[model samples]
Target: MDLIEVLQHRYTAKAYNPDRRLPEEIVAQLMAALRFSPSSVNAQPWHFIVAGDEAGKARVAKGAAGPFAYNAPKILNASHVVLLCARTTLPPEHLQAVLDQEQADGRFAGEEAREGQRKTRAGYVALHEQAGDLGMWTQKQAYIALGFLLLAAGTLGVDATPMEGFDAEALDGAFGLTDKGLAPAVIVALGYHSDADFNAKLPKSRLADSVVFSRA
Candidate 1:
């Protein structure tokens, strides 16, 4: 299907059919797509841990709970869950791959990627910058991951919900995410549909496009 059509038909799936499990290859493809999502200067910072087993999903659910998550059994009961991660340090393996792309795409103009570097160094260099800048930067990259994963899942017919109605601190502790030097930026539960968890469905409320534009 065309990208626009795929988007038009897609909805946030709050419920999932537990019996369905996405194929391993498809999951890999989805994540690979996320790796290429744009970020600040192609920092491309994000981590993904896909938990296909029930036990793992439950563990994550317990740690992260928000008011709307009640009755989200289909989400909790889905066959697979993905823990989207942000880290203090970028992984070496992931960095080298992007550097390879910069070499080919001219994003770096034959700079910084010449060596067989396993990782590229990136972060906010201005220590004096306000904390808000860092916060915005982190959230922006996280959302890029969300966007890519959601679209890829829709393309592959794996319905999912981008869940933030949860406790991040609790989740990080429960998952022992610190071991990997990462923490959850979001939780995306993926599976087929069941006849439960019908929520958040309504016409999207938005200001008119003109209201959001500056026509001076």
Candidate 2:
């Protein structure tokens, strides 16, 4: 596949055809792609909540009410919606969990490698904690996963809209995310674009290459 062609074809879909739904097999792969997205120090301090059913989507749509009402219909009409959340605090148990998963997945060569990995990750976590930036740092990492998912969706020929137009606290409450130590960072609505989506036909706009790229 021509990567540039895929990129050219992708855009922020304004509306989705509610009649269309992502196939379960494709959805499964997208989930896996999100799971494998990169994160700082392999902390992986994020949680992805998938909403494919009508009821579930409606619940998520609640966050878009009030000041965020403009986003409600997109959330409801999309075939699937994913809530990207970041850990409120990366406590010891959380870091340990990452280490444990790494070990279980045979990511370590031996005890020395495992210990080294743990120490490096711990130091970074400690730095963030000391600076009172743990939450912000984790939220930044969550966006990296968001970027990965967007590109992956484009490659898979799925239309996607990355959104930050909802009330984070409301979303957290609706999904009981804060109780799980996660805070809503962003949302993505995925599906096929509607035939009436005028944005699809508009030319893509970007800064001139010289203004965006530089060589040292």
Pairs of residues clashing in candidate 2: none
Tell me the deviation in Å of residue 199 in model 2: 0.8
- Estimate every model's Cα lDDT from 0 to 1: 0.69, 0.92
Q: Which stretches of candidate 1 lie over 4 Å from their true place?
A: 65-72, 88-124, 127-132, 178-180, 197-216
* 1-216 per-residue lDDT for model 2 (tens digits): 688888888899989899999999889888988999999999999999999999989988989989889889889999999999999888889889999999999999999999999999999989999999999999999999998898889999999999999997788778888789988999999999998888999998889989999999
lDDT of 1 by residue, 179-214 (tens): 866767878878776776464354435587789998
List ranges where model 2 is wrong by over 4 Å.
none
Worst 10 residues of 1 by lDDT: 119-128
Compared with the true structure, model 1 gives a TM-score of 0.74
TM-scores for all candidates: the values are 0.74, 0.97
